[model samples]
Target: MNIAFQDSKDIDKEQVMKLYNDVGWYAYTKDASTLNNALRASLDVISAWDGEELVGLIRVVGDGLTILYIQDILVLNAYQNQGVATQLMEQVMQKYEHVRQKVLLTEEASDVRHFYEKNGFASCDKGSLVAFAKLEG
Candidate 1:
């Protein structure tokens, strides 16, 4: 598979929505315009493409100095076992190599943990760090 990566946020909204939906992230896809706007506003966006297909993407939001929060990293189901997500993350890591803090919040699943761990992320509990979130009602 010939995969190309780009640091771009001007992706097609329909393609972004389709990718999110295919990954079962219906909550993000529910409001296409809002999702598109968020993507546009992100500090960084790295996307993977197999020929013309949008197979994976990783996005960040941060001040580009002290902290960089990985807002999203996803690969299409068919492309999961491949290194698409890893490549996307590598791009993010390389871009922010000097940043002190890199953070992400994701679902609690063994595979999810393993994936992030393999990519150099540590569990908050392991680091004695705490995380909290407030979901809108």
Candidate 2:
């Protein structure tokens, strides 16, 4: 349970792919090159590693001054309830403390909703805000 945190996207390909697959994010793993490039383009990436294993990650992308979109936050199922995600989030919050708007989009399951709410993110419907997306494959 000795997970270490890092402000890095220096993860090797295999580790990154395995983490995404294990989390059922097959869309990201569908194209390794695209995933790698996206990671590099992120505003910031904070991750948790259990030795050589990619246990958890949180990344943000946006204009650094006015808006930040939390692009992803995933923790291996085995490590889900262990505060790894929380630590990664604390890193994002600390690094972006001056930024005013932080946004995230996720499924509407209760556990998922609770997790984000506990992390200080409010649902758009509950606030004076709205979010929209268009996905193509």
Candidate 3:
């Protein structure tokens, strides 16, 4: 298994589109038309490929200087237990090495939480900054 990382500009849009769609609910999809836009806007994108195939991908969507929000941390089903996600996250974390506050939201998954913890993230309990999202447009 050959593992390599690449940014948005270096990735193939079609492969990323497939990866994003492959992991369905974890990464909800509306339309395929936005894939290009989404990838273009990503602060940093790291993908893990096995030879000529895409096996995993993680995208960071945030302001580069201070806050980095990890968006899509996904690994294809076949590559789940091979440290592909860790490699992708390592690249993302490295890109934000100087960021003071990093945040990300996932679907209350224990495994995901463990992954974040492994990456130096902890549950906020000190009444620091609260997150609020506008549920409706």
lDDT of 1 by residue, 1-137 (tens): 99999889999888898899999999898889999999999998999999888999999999999999999999999999888998899889998999999999999999999999999999997868998888894
RMSD of 3: 2.3
Ten contiguous residues with the weakest lDDT in model 2: 6-15
| Residue 34 of model 1, lDDT score | 90
Residue pairs clashing, model 1? none
* Per-residue lDDT of candidate 3, residues 1-137 (tens digit): 77877675467766777777777732344554566678677888777888888888887887889899887788888789789998888877787789987888776678877887888877663357666555552
Candidate order by TM-score, decreasing, is 1, 2, 3
Q: lDDT of model 2 at residue 4?
A: 93
Best model per lDDT: 1
Per-prediction TM-score to the true structure, in the order listed: 0.97, 0.95, 0.84
Better of 1 and 3 by lDDT: 1
What lDDT does candidate 2 reach at residue 77? Answer: 89
Q: Which has the higher TM-score value, candidate number 1 or candidate number 2?
A: 1
For model 3, the superposed segments whose C-alpha errors exceed 4 Å read 26-28, 125-129
Among all windows of 10 consecutive residues in model 3, the one with the lowest summed lDDT is 25-34
Which segments of model 1 are wrong by more than 4 Å? none
lDDT at 112, model 1:
94
lDDT of 1: 0.93
Scored by lDDT, model 2 comes in at 0.90
